[model samples]
Target: MNASMGPTLQTQGFYDRSTGTVSYVVWDAATRAAAVIDPVLDFDSKSGHTATRSADGLLAFLHGKELRLAWILETHAHADHLSAARTLQERAGGRIAIGENIRQVQTTFKTLYNLGREFLPDGRQFDHLFADGESFILGDLEATAMLVPGHTPADMAYRIGDAVFVGDTLFMPDVGTARADFPGGDARTLYRSIRRLLDLPGATRMFVCHDYPPQGREPCWETTVREQRERNVHVHDGITEDAFVAMRTARDASLEAPSLILPSLQVNIRGGQLPEREANGVAYLRIPLNALRTVGSMPARHGSA
Candidate 1:
């Protein structure tokens, strides 16, 4: 614990090596109330199997710690891994929530997937939808949600005490930042969003949702505003918006789509609920052929995050 952050806030990260994603359990030590951020639902594409091992581990931790679940937060609808929000909620009660801009993402994918009218894009799927700058209480801590779209249109960062969970907005300084080539993504917009987080106090703790470490370095998720602003290769202190955009655009062009994009988005948009079962009782995921530009493309610069 950072002495400056007081004794209330505590955080533990769960890393999913399969997807290179990190899920966090942050709680108020005094109140024992907690929030689970970006939990992963284990998925095997080859066999079309889903498991709760990852999420169940988190639940076990919560139970062992005697912490009360308050919120299950998603930074955005992910493209790389399935969400465990609904699964976690079924086992442990919490308000499952995400940014309100998810409606836009829902609309875009609904058309691409040709989802039926049964699905609604009104953001009702989530227990709550947070607007930019919205404030909420987690135990005794006051947390604020900040919209940080770039990698995706609905990305949000949660600021609790002195720590911020930046979902895909910025990776570790060595890894730079997330790609901004997805639908509704803009390099200029991403650069501005990154600057917003960096503007926080230099000592602010920044937690990344994903980390793809380079060779010889182990995975790490925690960094500071000061570290990012000073060492981030893509957008360091002296990097201009134009220069960053140019670099991101070129870099994203050479990347391939995430392996689980099809299944991940379908389940994620529904607040982590699998697609409604068909008459046969098996839920199906749609894959639009030759639809996404990233299909059959060259290898990704950084593997899915």
Candidate 2:
């Protein structure tokens, strides 16, 4: 997709049709310093093959414009696709950052997946952990990390200049919001976080992490705060918090698990590090037998991995 020019930030979105994810590369055009958000490492769950095509695509875009990479930020530990943060960091030389609350996410999944005690949920895996309302520099553009937990305890939204990259907290007005049934997810919290985003100036542009386009429409990832407030079916004007939570909770119960949840979390928890190699230098993935219950089978239990 062509880049959109914000007041001070240049933004572009890449669509991964395989997982319905939209990764972004944002930079200060004047300084050419850039950061990427929620990059994907292409993983074929059926065959267990991982590829760097998606990350490489982002690199090509930055290199094409001679942008200096500064940060690879994860909005959260995703459940739909493996993070390409480590791969991007190695090639682009940028710090990897996520919300400090990622420790809680790591801990929740650690026990569920039976990870060893060697794995500490201390938020040390990433190069930096951002606190709520934290401010930083991405070239000349001022960036702030806003804690927007609901889809996951670690979820964060990055506000740069007049644009905000909101991961999984929202979708196009017609598609409504993301599901909040993941461990540590709460519909009530998500509603408030969304209100905060909507309260921004009407012209504030918003970007989303994924887009599930309904039939007969093309995928979209950019919308203005005003557009959402006026049209977002799930949380638009007059939608009470009680109404949102009730609607969101009921909807989530009927949804099936994300196709990549198991594989994604294992790599995501370690900052996108694959499992350690065994004596034979082969890293194997574990598949628990009937350990997970699908939606409507039983209430999903939360745990520490």
Candidate 3:
């Protein structure tokens, strides 16, 4: 367990290789009150099986540290992996939260997925919906939520003490930034949001949500604003907004949609709760035919048996 410690706050990151996601546990040293950020729910798309291994590991860590879970925070509704937020809240007794802009995301996906009258597009699915610059108490430490959209319209970064949990806005310096091509994402807007984050104190600790390492390099999730400014290949100090946008747009054009986007969003938009079970008690995810242009041409149709 690799942990970074401040005078009053402590942070430990849990990286899941299957999805390249890093979930964090941050706490106030004085009270042992903690929050879990962007936890992953293990999902096997082939078998349509879901497991609690990742969430269970977090629960075990909290129990071992004698930490009380005060919050289960989601950086955004993810597209690559299922979230473990609802499961963790059920097992540990903490409030689940996401950015208030999630209502926009919910509205968009609800239309695409046809989530019907039962699923409300409002942000009520979560225990709390944080607005930009909102402040809340985590034990004895004061934490603030910063709106950092562009990777998605609802992305948020949580700043607690000297550490900042930046969710998908930036990655490790060697890996660069997230692609701004998803729904409601804009390359120019992403550049500005990243610059806003770079404005923080140079020495502030920055923990990323995902890390896609290059050849011969190990996975890493932590960096600092100073290092990112000096070394981030995509948005270093001298890279202008125009240059970043041009590069991001071209790169995003070549990229395919996330493999689990269909399943992940359908579940994530519901605060990690699976869709309501059918009459046979099976919950199923919907995949709209020919909806995403990024997907290849449709297969030739064949007669049914």
Candidate 4:
């Protein structure tokens, strides 16, 4: 239970195959108002086909509950998922928001993706660009965006009541925190960021963005600071900064690229909206042939060791 909390916050997770990204819908039980976080827009890499199967599921859930959606919140521009937030905003009639630092990420990737000069990195794509420590409303629930960058320059954790929707910062205690090897990612910085999250109240329920199934357990996304501190292999209570960095660097060095890294970054940096249609008015995403040779090569790992 939350400390002096009022209406309970309900959360559900949905996974998309295109990038193995997990999307969530969180709501207030009393007012029947809700917010979707990191919702997925389905894409088929082989056929170049994109759809809304996952987003449709979220719409179905909202419809079934008769909840009024107030906003679509993204923790950051994901590098392994295509957010269906805009699509949901259109259907659910709510504003979409993300961290203000997203503009930096957008600028970095727009050049990488070779988007035309007309593409702006001013964060106009999102309804609102929240600054660190910014707070907003969702019916009876009060949510604040805390800047916890490491996995990416714009990554954030949403403190909704007693639960923090920590995008990809810290995972379930048994699993540990997200890797910091992507563009603009740093293991040392991630060490500091994870500490910030751990500094929260021990009882705070941490909701994760994605969960890779462990040895034999089903995928899950909820944990707590205490549990993580005591059991998380990477950053438990007494872990030192130097120890964490060495482990993180060695581990990150052995991991493979996210299956959808190439596509995820390009779409995510644009705030989930796909590229504009061509003269034929048909939208397309580019795959730079062999561009990931060395500059973009992913380290190969032996699973989650």
- List of clashing residue pairs for candidate 2: 109-305, 110-305, 111-304, 111-305, 112-305
lDDT of 3 by residue, 165-233 (tens): 989989999888987878788778888899999999999999999988888988888899999999998
Error of 1 at 39 (Å): 0.4
lDDT of each: 0.89, 0.87, 0.88, 0.78
Tens digit per residue, CA lDDT, model 4, 111-224: 667778788999998889999999898778888989988788788889887788888888777778788776677778888888988999999888788777678986677788
Candidate 2, 1-305: lDDT as tens digits: 64699767899999998888999999998899999999999998888889999999999998999989999999999988999999998888999999999999888777777888898989889999999999999998889999999888899999999899999998988889978878788889999999998988999999989888889989889999999999998999999999999998788777767777888888898898888789998887776557655322324432110
TM-score of each: 0.95, 0.95, 0.95, 0.91
Tens digits of per-residue lDDT for model 1, 1-305: 11123468999888898998999999999899999999999999999999999999999999999999999999999989999999999999999999999999998888878888988999999999999999999999999999999888899999999899999999999999998878888889999999999999999999999988899988889999999999998998999999999998888887777888888998999999987788999988898875654322323444532
Candidate 1 structure lDDT: 0.89
Count backbone clashes in candidate 4.
3
How far in Å is the alpha carbon of 244 misplaced in model 4? 1.0
Residue-level error in angstroms, candidate 2, position 161 = 0.8
Clashes (backbone N, CA, C under 3 Å), per candidate, total 0, 5, 0, 3
Q: After superposition, how far is residue 190 of candidate 3 from its true place, in Å?
A: 0.7
Which regions of candidate 3 fall more than 4 Å away from where they truly are? 294-305
Descending-lDDT candidate ranking: 1, 3, 2, 4
